[model samples]
Target: MSGYFVTEGSKCKGRPLTTLPVVINRDLSRIINNNLQLKSSHDLEHLRYIAQQRDEWTKLTARIQEAAEASQSEH
Candidate 1:
């Protein structure tokens, strides 16, 4: 399968080469109707999500930089 990638034991197949997983809360309507005046709950959720993403990216970036430095030293 041209669109499949082997990972460990399972074979994951999918569309093209790019895809992003997204989760849309079903309670969105309820949240919106609750008059979440100052910094709505949804906004808070988005902020928390972005913070988590930033932390994850920072960790991955640090690991990559460390690996690159080590690899260069070995050469």
Candidate 2:
């Protein structure tokens, strides 16, 4: 468990810290694809989903930046 963290829950999950970038990339790609398929921004539901995705993207970007800074400082 040296390079892993266990999430607290009934079905405890563990994943390597290094895999975070891959997950973020996958999520961002999915969001971009969804947005690319949008024909119009008039639908309220679609607008809400887009807003949510934006927030997720922002958070992921921050996390990635933080990770990069941490890694840099470790040198």
Q: How does candidate 2 score on lDDT?
A: 0.47
lDDT of 1 by residue, 16-72 (tens): 344221111222222322322223455555535544898864754455466556667
Please name the candidate that would achieve the greatest lDDT relative to the true structure: 2
- Return the top candidate by TM-score: 2
lDDT of each: 0.41, 0.47
Which regions of candidate 1 deviate over 4 angstroms?
1-52
Colliding pairs, model 2: none
Candidate 1 TM-score, true structure as reference: 0.32
TM-score to native of every candidate shown? 0.32, 0.33
Tens digits of lDDT, candidate 2, 1-75: 212233455543685344543454444444322332222233334435555898864765565566666667989
The alpha-carbon root-mean-square deviation between model 2 and the true structure, to one decimal in Å, is 13.4
Q: How many residue pairs clash in all the candidates, one count each? A: 0, 0
Candidate 2 matches the true fold with a TM-score of: 0.33
